[model samples]
Target: MAEHNLGDSHQVFDGEGKTFTINDKHVAIFNINGDLFAFEDACKHMGGSLGKGKLEGNLVACPNHGWQYDVTNGKCVTENECESGCRVDTFPVKTENNEIILSLPE
Candidate 1:
């Protein structure tokens, strides 16, 4: 695992998501009530960009198909009944010196 600095935490406003690339991997970082969460940028349903989605509390609605996912855990909330094993990849996030840091798998 490697930590990548994602700029200042304030760059991502509350209830918003931002996209970043670390080690050639695209990641979506979300800010919820001053907390940071990281996940894959692409939606599992149709390859939609989750970073461009709308954030509602801890859930982010996919822009392409309206699929909602929990930003904190990357759980597919829109298709919980389908049990399709469709889930976005989640990564660890932290803040140091007001900078958002994301852990990416090496």
Candidate 2:
């Protein structure tokens, strides 16, 4: 596993999400009620950017087709119309020294 430092945690507001490209992967980071969650930026349904989607509580709605996913576990909350398992890849995230760190597969 590799740890990528995503900037200060303060940069991400509560109920909002951010995107970062690390090692050629688009990672989405979310701040939900002061906690952090990280996952693949692409939606499982149609490759929509989850970071650009709307966040409601722990759920994020894909901007392309309204597919909702839980930022906490990357599980699809809405209908699973995706033939290819409707779950986004989730990453381990933590806050250390005020910085958001994401652990990605090496």
- List lDDT for all candidates, in order: 0.87, 0.89
Counting clashing residue pairs in each candidate, in order, gives 0, 0
Q: Tell me the tens digit of each residue's lDDT in model 1 across 74-94.
A: 889885542566689999999
- Please report, as a residue range, the 10-residue window in candidate 1 with the lowest summed lDDT: 78-87
Whose lDDT is greatest here? Answer: 2
Over 4 Å off, model 2? 83-85
Off by over 4 Å in 1: 80-84
Task: Give the clashing pairs for model 2.
Answer: none
**All models, RMSD in angstroms:** 1.6, 1.5
- Candidate 2, overall lDDT? 0.89
Whose TM-score is greatest here? 2
